[model samples]
Target: MYAPQDDTTLLVDALADEPLAPGARVLDVCTGTGALALEAARKGGRVTAVDVSWRAVCTARLNARLAGLPVRIVRGNLFAPVAGQSFDLILTNPPYVPAPGAHRMPRGAARAWDAGQDGRLVLDRICREAPALLRPGGVLLMVHSALSGADPTLRLLRAAGLTASVTERRWVAFGPVLREREGWLRERGLLSADDEKEELVVIRAERPV
Candidate 1:
């Protein structure tokens, strides 16, 4: 299982290379260990982190404290906790797994994984709501699977009135599919049994100035 802070290093490295304006307001949705939010704070942004899982919020709070970063960690689903709050920068690495037939997630995995059947539940919602929560000229950075590809995501972002683009990509082994799930996926033509892995796509979109 991946740790809550699994992608902290990569996210931090990216942000460090592209620093936000000083005193910028930032939000990290699905802030699984507060890594992005804390890192943003460290870089001089006023940061707020939100997550659906209570445990994740607690862990994120502890992580911020341990890292000596002052980030506000809130427990709530998606943008609900920060309704009417807009920010200069928003970042998220949401749950993006396409599990069709699974009745329930493996115990501990629910907090970090499980997108919808097409792996777009959280992603779609975020895209739809992001424009409203971003100040004009603000940016929204999101990391998700390339399995669904970038076209649809870009289309969604545009429809939401934001300009979007692929910022980074990395290919990684997603592991074997369960036998029954594999058969199901093949029937739907979503995947082949021989397919061994997938790619992760990081995208960044910006609200118009």
Candidate 2:
């Protein structure tokens, strides 16, 4: 299971501005440690959290139980567990690191952030699938690093017929993952020598009523 990180914080901060009413249906995809789901529950939402990793599912369920928050934690690929169900809010912090191979079914710790090649493998799926999961007037909030191309994310969301924009951005120093792959990132022109920080972004999209 991916531990909560800077990207998680950005998404959580964005959620604070969202107006979730009592019993609002909220889905947290790729939920790590159930942080987003728990927060939504605390804010009066009927929350469900899903992750492909069994460890993630177990950890999230345990966290929700310890927090005494009523979250429906499930183990499944994104959107699979909630088929035909729509939500008022959808939150995700999927894998976005530019990893080595095109390994779709990532294993071990790589499951946390081993997005293949350009780092949009999981993100693209989310974009293509999220609109169908949202109720009319529902909101989707997602977070990732600028290296993953925030513009592409906005474009994808817009193409999917949602009003999307980057709602929040923060420049954070390179974490261990980025630092370890610095040379490779430079080869791909995703980073530069003077680039001391990576921009974390929270993208918000709303489905039309």
lDDT of each: 0.78, 0.92
Which stretches of candidate 2 lie above 4 Å from their native place?
103-105
Question: Which lDDT tens digits does candidate 2 get at residues 35-154?
Answer: 999999999999999998888999999999999999999999899899999999999999999986675567787878889889998999999999999999999999998899999999
Clashing residue pairs in all predictions, respectively, total 0, 0
- Candidate 1 local Cα displacement, residue 93, angstroms: 0.2
Q: Using lDDT as the measure, which candidate wins?
A: 2
Off by over 4 Å in 1: 1-10, 102-108, 175-187
Candidate 2 versus the native: TM-score?
A: 0.97
Candidate 1 residue-wise lDDT, 1-209, digit = tens? 34643244555656776658988999999888777898899889999999878788899999888888889999988999999999999988888767774555524646476665777767888888888999999988888776555678899999999999987777665533333355565676667667755666777888899
TM-score of each: 0.87, 0.97
Clashing pairs in 2: none
**The candidate that achieves the highest TM-score relative to the unseen native structure:** 2
- Pairing residues by index, what is the TM-score of model 1? 0.87
